[model samples]
Target: MQLTITYFALLRDQRGLDTETIDSPAATPAELYTQLAEQHSFTLPSSALKVAVNDDFAHWTTPLKDGDTIVFIPPVAGG
Candidate 1:
């Protein structure tokens, strides 16, 4: 399946790109992330990241369908 992935804030800096299209056999958010991390040579810390599917916040185990738009938002810090 093919999915569109977006990186925000620090995550975008780590990836060096704002968005990308990924191909994977992964069904859940966690599995897809594992594949993406390996392919992109970046570590994605699940505990510190928030995931969104099709513009809505999603759980780690949320199933991903073809053509889904996924976004990874890293933890934000401010005073």
Candidate 2:
């Protein structure tokens, strides 16, 4: 599937980019995240994250489709 993934804050720093489009075999947000996290050496796991699809909050197990836009949000600390 061809999807656009948007990385934010910590993820953006780790990925070295804000957004990217790629072809992947992952069937769900969780799968895709796990793959990217491994490939990118992301220290934060999906257990500490939230996912969104097409600008709407989505479950990690939600099904993915071609042309979907995904966002992975990591926990943020604010003063």
Candidate 3:
């Protein structure tokens, strides 16, 4: 299935885009992330990334459906 993926902060810089479309064979958020990271060579610790599905925060085991909007946010820091 095809899902829309959005990258924030450091992830966007590394990926060179804020949003993209990804195709995955798995049904959960974690699976999709694994697929994307492998496909794009994005080196990020899974524990350091937050995921949102369809604009709401989602757990790794959250089920994914066609056309779901998924956003990946990396850890943020401030002074």
Q: What is the TM-score of each candidate against the true structure?
A: 0.85, 0.94, 0.86
Per-residue lDDT for 25-77 in model 1, tens only?
A: 88998888777777667665778788899999999998889999998777778
Model 2 CA lDDT for position 43? 94
Which residue pairs show collisions in model 2? none
Candidate 3 residue 44 Cα shift, in angstroms, is 1.5
Tens digit of per-residue lDDT, candidate 3, span 22-76: 7777798888878778877888978888888999888989989999999877876
Q: Quantify all predictions' global Cα lDDT against the true fold.
A: 0.84, 0.94, 0.84
What is the TM-score (0 to 1) of candidate 2?
0.94
Q: Candidate 1 vs candidate 2: which has greater lDDT?
A: 2
Runs of candidate 2 with Cα error greater than 4 angstroms are none
How far does residue 67 in candidate 3 sit from its true spot (Å)? 0.9
Model 1 misplaced regions, further than 4 Å: none
Candidate 2: global Cα-lDDT? 0.94
